[model samples]
Target: MLNIALFGPPGAGKGTQSKMLIEKYNLAYISTGDILRGEIAEGTELGLQAKDIIKRGGLVPDEIIVQIMEERIQTDTEVNGFLFDGFPRTTVQAYILEGLLLKMNTKLDCMLSLEVPTDQLRNRLLDRAKKENRSDDTEEVISVRLKEYDTKTAPVANFYKEKEIYHGIDGLGGIDQIFERLTSVVDQTLQKSWINLVLLGPPGSGKGTQGRKLAEQFNLEYISTGHLMRQEIKKDTEMGQSAKTYMEKGDIVPDEIAIRLIERQIRKHPDANGFIFKGFPRTIVQAYILDGLLRKLGSVVTSSINLDVSTLESIKRLTYRGKTEGKRLYDDTDIIIHRLEQFEKRSIKVSNYYSKQDKFEIVNGLGSEEDVFKRLTDVVNKSFKKIR
Candidate 1:
């Protein structure tokens, strides 16, 4: 997900620009002042605390602010990204935000600084005062506010600049023109964050279960070849018709057909942070096809993780599932064993393929769902760090 910290002087049109960015990019707008005032208005415990502090002419401590920010972030789970405005006003707060995002298994993608001349800012604020009759927009008040912004907020830009994710945009000209400039920088930054992953394992290894969780945790598109083929067949499309012919004959679909299905899924999510390919590339040929497709897309497989479940465990899980679910025809003992053998043969070859590229990982899948997920996430986190 895209996480942006927007920086600007008082009259650099941050409010207008952030709203446009939110609408265009599906980002959740987060302004610290709005969050704090919302807390006070709600009369919750944190609100009461913040109210009392404000009443006593005291600044809320960083810990309290962090708590509020964390709570706000947790409550919003469906956003594409977060647009942080009027936050991290100090260098210390910038570090705090960094730690907070890292704790959430993500990081700030960039800081977009809107640059406006001081005279232009004064004229804009004065024009706004005339239009809205805002008493706070007086000459002296605007000077103090701008000076305070320079003192407190300017250094935070340096913090991001050091990391090389800072993009300075000219906050002049028409609103649409300015937005175009912002989008140009934002689009490039988001592209860098896109990553593709492959999840490999035999049946009953929980790769499908874990793949869904990974997709949610990392804001990725989850693509399972089996699921994609089923969807295609359900839709009765051309590829579906061809796939149906092979399935009716109990034959595997051609690699080209499977590759087309994978390609279709990838194209469906042009703006996704990445994809988790679950149970695709079942053969070495398919693996090469996938690599070629990704190369065409200007991305590479970040990792091919095998969820290593023991043979006994895989058999037991399949047996239990067959008895309990009574729907998996292939879960019959003989068929299950045959399938596992085939999977083992293919998995080892594909694992070796990725190993040669230094992008293979083995995660222990014999544990509680949460435990296995934690191991998977650990591997994913390490891979993401290497990419960034």
Candidate 2:
């Protein structure tokens, strides 16, 4: 997902540029002032706290603002990305936002700062005050606002600057010209941001364990096909119903259905740095289809890892797991052997497809879990190094 924080002082034309970028990029506008007003209007708990603070002529605390911002983000899950305006007013808030986004498996792609001369900003605000006849936009009020931005907001630039995601757009040009600069920077930032990985291995090869670990380490969304299908079925979505019909008849869900579900999950997290795909593309045809799907999204598989474990070792692990865990359905010795045999028959072809693209690796999955995880991380780090 493409997430940006728009930074500028008053009268730097942030509102004007924000409108154009929102339409062009399909981003959800997340303005802190709008959220606060909505909360107050709805009389929610946070709203009451904010209202009380306003009644006492006090600035709302940053922690409260962050709490409300997270609530908004959690509730509004359908979007290509987010445009953050007027929230991170301090260096502390910038760090908080980074942690918050990391927790959500996404990261702010950039902070587009509109840089304008003091005289120009003052002149623009004065002209705006005259045109709109806004009493609050008086010279004195604008001065205070600009001072607050300088003292409290301007330092946010340094925070993003250190992260190398800060871009400064000259706020002195024509509206269209400034917008072109913003989009150019945005396009370049997006090109270098995504990290898609697919995990391929047999049932007892620790795909789930390693996939989850890598996703958290790198801030990527983890897509487990079995879990995704179960979630859809629980929600009774149309796609889920269709898959259910096939599954009830002891049939494999068609590749079209699986691909559609995977695409839906991918689009749900437009702000995600990338995805860790587990258990989806089981066939050579499915691998081809997955590649096409990611291509449509302007991404490709960064790496496809096969966790190499012997058949006897896999049997031993599954048997021990069956006695201790008892959660997986395919843990029976006979079913485990059958599943491994089928995977060996079909998934090797899928692995070869990725290998031909020079994006395939085999990590030894023997020994202790920690040892295996180290081997997996080595391959992953190498893949992501090339991506970055």
Candidate 3:
């Protein structure tokens, strides 16, 4: 579901744009103020309780508002998604809403904040009061409300921003122009929600072929550690020189050096829909470091696809490629066996780490390219469905 939170101070035209969004997206609208007023008009029990609080010049409690929202969400069942309006007024309420949505097996896809000047907001509210005859919208009341928003409600935007799902929309334009901006943000968020994956395999297990296919098919960035390392060496950066020294000695590059290179590449694509990590995180330590990096970005490795191929099959394939392409690394059978042994030792621990998180899947690599590609895509699509 494409759940969204519409955020703005008073008189930012959220009500106008929300109606257009509902028409375009078939979203279920949930405005706490609207619901409370309806309940009061019907003289329901909760409404009476709220009215009594108002009569005593007190605000309704947060618990009451949460309960009302929970009830509303449970009863609504015929919408494509939800547009939250005039709810989650505080940071605490924002966290509460997250828990509620999680229990329902959904989450907010994005939070759209409308940015408008304070003077414009005030003028708009005064004009609205004249048209709607709302005594409560006086200039004094609007000032207090805006002040309260700055103090309490603005933090809610920060909460979503930390999750990388907050989008600030310019709320100063014609209605259609503003709507177009809001829709573009939503579209980008949906695109970025695709699951990022890592592909793990030994030498000659077809990781390159399948990774490229999956990235192209799903519109994800394809990241290869070997490719990145070679690029770094060509650039002759400090870390690249360190890696080159190890390569000159016929030694594997240290995990720290490889991870730094990969991290740099990952940072370059901050707005990618997702990434296919090819030939990376080959050891348990690298896997942990990768997790930390993703957490800092408000993301996680959706799954790790391990391609399983026999040692003999890998050696044969590499030997054939070496003869055809004149590559020395793959020409020696003894070196190929040693590399396979090293891979088995480190990869088992890495696989166990992801297995505990239920994010590991193994596919047979001794097959036609089409067959292997199909298996890889199946796991990816399944992971996407679980997260959604």
Q: How many pairs of residues collide in model 3?
A: 0
RMSDs, each prediction? 14.6, 17.0, 8.0
Q: What are the runs in model 2 whose C-alpha is more than 4 Å off?
A: 200-388
Best by lDDT: 1
Model 2 lDDT vs. the true structure? 0.82
| Candidate 2: residue 122 Cα off by (Å) | 0.8
Superposed Cα deviation of residue 367, candidate 3 (Å) = 1.2
Winner of 1 and 3 under lDDT? 1
Among all windows of 10 consecutive residues in model 3, the one with the lowest summed lDDT is 325-334
Per-model TM against the reference: 0.57, 0.56, 0.57
lDDT of each: 0.83, 0.82, 0.81
Candidate 2 Cα deviation (angstroms), residue 73: 0.5
Native-to-model Cα distance after best TM-score fit, residue 145 in candidate 1, in Å:
1.1
Which residue runs of candidate 1 sit more than 4 Å off their true CA positions? 198-200, 203-388
- Taking all chains together, the TM-score of candidate 1 against the true structure is 0.57
On residues 44-153, what C-alpha lDDT tens digit does candidate 1 reach at each position?
89888988998999999888899899898877666666899988888889989987875554578789999999999999999999999998778999999888988887
